[model samples]
Target: MTDLRQLRHFVAVAEHGHFARAAAAINLSQPALSRSIQALEANLGCNLFDRGARNITLTAHGQLVLEHARRLLAGSRALHNAVSQLGNLQAGELRLGAGPYPAARLIPIALGELARRYPKVRVQLLIEDWASLRRRLLNENIELFVADCRELRDDPLLSVEPLRVRPMLFFCRPGHPLLALAEPSAADIAAYSLAATQLPEDGARRLQETLGREPLPDIQCDNFMVLKELVRQSDVISFAPEDVLTSALVGGELATLPPREVLPRKGSAYGLVSRAGHSLSPAAQALRALIFAGDVVAQ
Candidate 1:
């Protein structure tokens, strides 16, 4: 049976490229560390290293074993973390991913509630586009994410639960020319350059249907902050979920165009998405529950 300790020793040696340094790192005598590596190679019936007088390098077989060894060690660590956090949400870490819009609007409230409840629990959030968040979740870089449920539906590896429905609204800085119009046609809105957040395909379809045509935004950004800034400075019309501009709206920096009645409330839904079959840590689950409870599914 291969010992995990021996694998650790091998990894340390491979990383350091010197037995003395590796032994120091692992707090073992050089001879003991060397013996451990020898035992590992002997058990596998192969020379795991091309040991030279100056430095050592992994042999072809060593490289193969190193990859698997690293994976095994990583899995072991994950298992240990899961076990440690099984029932203890007070001290463990919670890692979450979200797109810019959700990160800006919904996450702050849920996170605030989480912090109020479990002050010791550490929370890490990654904000990016859906594609980036999806990749991070698939890689286990994050425990879960809040994003477009539509994107999560296409991937078989992810489990999704709908959290909130946010309607799309055309907005602009206060006193923009569009606000003067009682009911602006699609062409009227299209006449001015617009900036908007990147929408999923379904969201794009909905927007097109609402506009009665496919109106291409002059600036398409995944980050809502960028669109908000563009709308604030330039005459560019901003189009995105109402939540994305909640702060700006509250601060009186931005306002919906063509009146609230003209805006389409049939917008996108965001959800809690995690890798299928992967267990979340206790802190993560706690945060998820908090967010779900607070989400409230807008009418």
Candidate 2:
């Protein structure tokens, strides 16, 4: 088989139309470079060049081989770049999984920052429950997950970094019964049905643990936009991330409970967590570094 180095030498010589100059450009002696091209031609069973005592000219076969050789060299350089830049935070897809509301905000912000710096890299997003997200990551379905750290509970299969705290806000249609109250207690609001994401296990447990009872939602789904829509149409209430609710609040489609001193600014502490011990692709790691470097700060 024609070796990559051999093809490289042949293509360089073809482009420069002179072996001596090609060898000089590549920091090799002309004879050594000639030998490499000769080997490549011999392996391919074709004469790639017609050499005079002083100058080398392309054979008809040289034109065809030169085309393929240039392509091979270009691809080889691309392969090298793809591998090298992985560490430089420059390229590759970041498979991301996240909770809907947080994902709505964090994913957009992080991806925008990633795009500005590494525009060539792509991002694939999926919103799912923590259990499903964890499962997908273990199966190599995703590279990173923006998850609520509190839900992770000491699993050795993951690595996490805290991003920001999210505070939960209750939402209801304007003039809903509980909204009229000066300060409604959990029970007062509890009288009305709860409309929550009802995420599998993890989110469910956190919700019940907070309210001291399993919340029977008036509606449930994994979509944040749908959850907001439910609150806008009826008296349904959902505790959602502040960022996701921004447009709704501004449009008079929803409202918040006064900030709870007990809840964090981020009612839930969400972070970027990797699956177990898997090392990230160079591009993914680069994006992670920029994300943590405050480059993607809460935009």
Candidate 3:
């Protein structure tokens, strides 16, 4: 079979119409150029050129081959260019997942930056609880996810890169009865309706231990903003990372319940989670960099 190198040599000799000039143009010796064309002709079972006293011309078979060769070479160049674009993050798709918190806090910032820098890159973001996100990742529905990693850290099938820890707090509307207490105990806070997004297994266990019962949300929502609005309108108490409530806290739309020994001070441990041995695509790597950098900026 004829190879690209041979076809290239054949095309060069055809264009230049002389063995010596074609060899010089292609940076090959005359003998090497002649040999490559000869091999191509032998492989194709047809003569490609007519040799004259001072010049060479293409035979009918050579004309057909030249047309096909140019098309093949053009297609080869296009394939290389597409691969280069993907490597540079200039063109590709990023399928990513995020738990409620990071979807609300971290992902938007990173996605904004990614869009600004690489407008050609398409993104599909799935916002779900950690367990669902983990399932999606393992099932190959997404490249990676950002979520609470407490349960996932010990999994032998996963690789986790922890993000900075934030503080968790229960908050309600400013004049909610709990804030009137100097320090409300978990029982005191639990008396009222509790609202929250889905919790990780460890988080639920801690909540159960603290409240002395199976923790159930009166209003469970994956969207924190909706939960925040609910908290503002009613006496319901909700817990979230401190940063998620920063605007509400600053604007006096909400106030945190005073600290109690029973409540966990540490927030959810968010991280980047992927299959242990799987490699991330270039687009995923670029987005991951922006995510880490956005975390720094948040701090």
**Candidate 3 ranges with C-alpha deviation above 4 Å:** 1-87
Q: TM-score for all predictions?
A: 0.72, 0.63, 0.69
Tens-digit lDDT track of model 3 for 1-299? 87888878887887888999999998999988888888898999999999899999999999999877866664454354347556567776677899888987789989999999988888899989888988867656677899888888899989899998888878899889887888888788778888888877667777877776665666789987888889999998888888887888899999987783556547669999988997777778888999999998888
How does each model score on lDDT? 0.78, 0.71, 0.83
By TM-score, the best candidate is: 1
Using lDDT as the measure, the top candidate is 3
Runs off by more than 4 Å, candidate 2: 1-91, 199-215, 258-266, 293-296
lDDT of 2 by residue, 29-81 (tens): 98899788878877889888898888888999998887767656655644554
C-alpha-based local distance difference test score of model 3: 0.83
Model 1 misplaced regions, further than 4 Å? 1-77, 205-215, 259-265, 297-299
Model 2: lDDT to the true structure: 0.71
Judged by lDDT against the true structure, how good is candidate 1? 0.78
